[model samples]
Target: MEEWTIEINRSATKKEKPNTDQLEFGRVFTDHMFIMDYSVPLGWHDARIIPYQPFSIDPSAMTFHYGQSVFEGLKAYYTPEGNIQLFRPEKNMQRLNRSNDRLCIPPIDEAFVLQAIKQLVYLDKDWIPTAEGTSLYIRPFIISTEPFIGVAPSHQYRLIVILSPVGAYYKEGINPVKIAVENQYVRTVKGGTGEAKTGGNYAASLKAQELCSQKGFTQVLWLDGVEKKYIEEVGSMNVFFKINGKVYTPALNGSILEGVTRNSVIQLLQHWNVPVIEERISMEVLYQAYLDGSLEEAFGTGTAAVISPIGQLSWEDKDLYINDGKTGKISRDLYNTLTRIQYGKEKDPFGWIDIVNEANAVKQ
Candidate 1:
């Protein structure tokens, strides 16, 4: 692993830290950003931390014209001892590289990316809200910069990381969310970039998401492109089901995004002796489970909400109620456990939190 050299952007100063009380998710940003340029010949170089500002891309830039871009989302938390840490960031790095592979984007060393994020977080530590359920949302993205009209991978690329102070994902409350099962539009198909965290997948889901909001649903529960009967995942998170006291999630189909929160929740459930089953769960089976009183709970996992419990799922004509339209016992337990570990309120038995204080965790 190569060490990242810090280039402090002293040009910016701390502004009024947004009222930790009224923070919004991914709306307000911090002071500085970390960026690097990539070229086929030079690879990733010219890394620096600079003031947060807009960039001027060529009208013909590949990313602008052809949509050759990918991104990842993760968070930084402030521990009780005033220390900063990232939760399972290695998983996010690995997922970003996986998305890179599928998009023909160059692979990045996880060590390098991790170091960059750590440096950025330490520099912008004040942006991390101390309020419970608030975090410093980190967005790492790669964009093709080759100014060409041709349809192909850009020889030149740019990777940038930005920080945002985010409050609780559910502004109204943690009340369970309603979801609309999308049977008409498919999120991803076999051998497609559905598994990748590319911009196009998100762009494709905008219409569906709009439709969801219009229909009084929080998000769209995406299904497989071919069968449409098999549940894949939610819009931006992985879906989970609990039937007959056993937890079940859709197996990693080629069309689903493997979320870090999804992985962490599964590991935590296993540690707590909860029965977790990953298999190809069909919509019909889930409805049957609900009818038979075997379906106990359902939720979506992601960085934003950690775990968002689903109250009800409505397909075109049918509606399935989950656990009296409230947060289930297992869902509450997992959320509390994860948040406790994050805020340093609970001992980290899984070695998941990466403490970032060199003076404490390491000797300078």
Candidate 2:
């Protein structure tokens, strides 16, 4: 619907590409980034792709003071056919608008933004890794740029998109991880910014995450703030538990960010005739199920780590092991299936892959 201007980064030279086998997550970035400015009466303008560089922002920027910002994470896969594709990117754009509504920011044109992303991805197509379990990570974010110190929302905002080449989320490749349930530190309560992909929610979890990491846990398992009984989510992904031959996940009870991969996992489960239930699940109940030896599989789903199996969970000094502390059969199956479809190695029956580089995919 709208056009995005392309500006090649002159005087830019490609660096030695990292060995995909040794690439860590989100450490290296591509040569270019997409940026747009937003101001009242003028709306969002000056959409362009430029060399990736630091932003010039005042110290009193609202995003820094009041934490008024939101971001989304997605990935581009280099298919076997030499094609690059994005999986369910529209969902990320829609979620961005939802986050904007919650943060008192202006909504963006989803179609236009998607086109801009396609153009950016196209420009950096060479940076898309083709190694096994490697991909180009896409981070799209909006920040309040108005250099004012006040309690109200900032008037000026900036939307930016940057790309990074990443290796497998887990160095061991689909290995199960350990998680510790957080009881003292709460992530967020209902009717809070928990549902929104804002910075504060993540910033708040850092301390707890640090504590958990010190205890050798991979990530902190968050609980709802109000009750602290119902399971909310993991720090980086929506979690799912398979017990007694059924799949159960913490519903979006106004406190969990709806994950695109989580939804895809659910859909895939249903399509494969596996039962899935979305509802409140307390840690006590889950532990009880574990005691009864019914907890079959536990995994967290996110864009970064598509499916992270939870081998062991520590709650209140008690450890509950899932599937003998190894990746479960279902977890392995889902990971293989989802990743196959992602890399275009198999036929996409869900119609989720969107090819970039297609004519009319992005307007000039």
Angstrom error of the Cα, residue 359, model 1: value is 5.8
- Writing each residue's lDDT as its tens digit, candidate 2 over 322-350 gives 89999998899999999999999988899
Residue-level lDDT for 117 in candidate 1 = 85
lDDT string, candidate 1, 201-276, tens digits: 9898998999889989999999889989999988799999988888999988788888888888889889988899
CA RMSD, predictions in order: 2.1, 1.7
TM-score for each of the candidates = 0.96, 0.96
After superposition, candidate 2 runs with Cα above 4 Å error: 2-11, 358-364
Off by over 4 Å in 1: 171-173, 358-364
Question: How many clashes would you count in candidate 1?
Answer: 0
Clash totals for all candidate models: 0, 0
Where is model 1 poorest over a 10-residue stretch in terms of lDDT?
A: 355-364
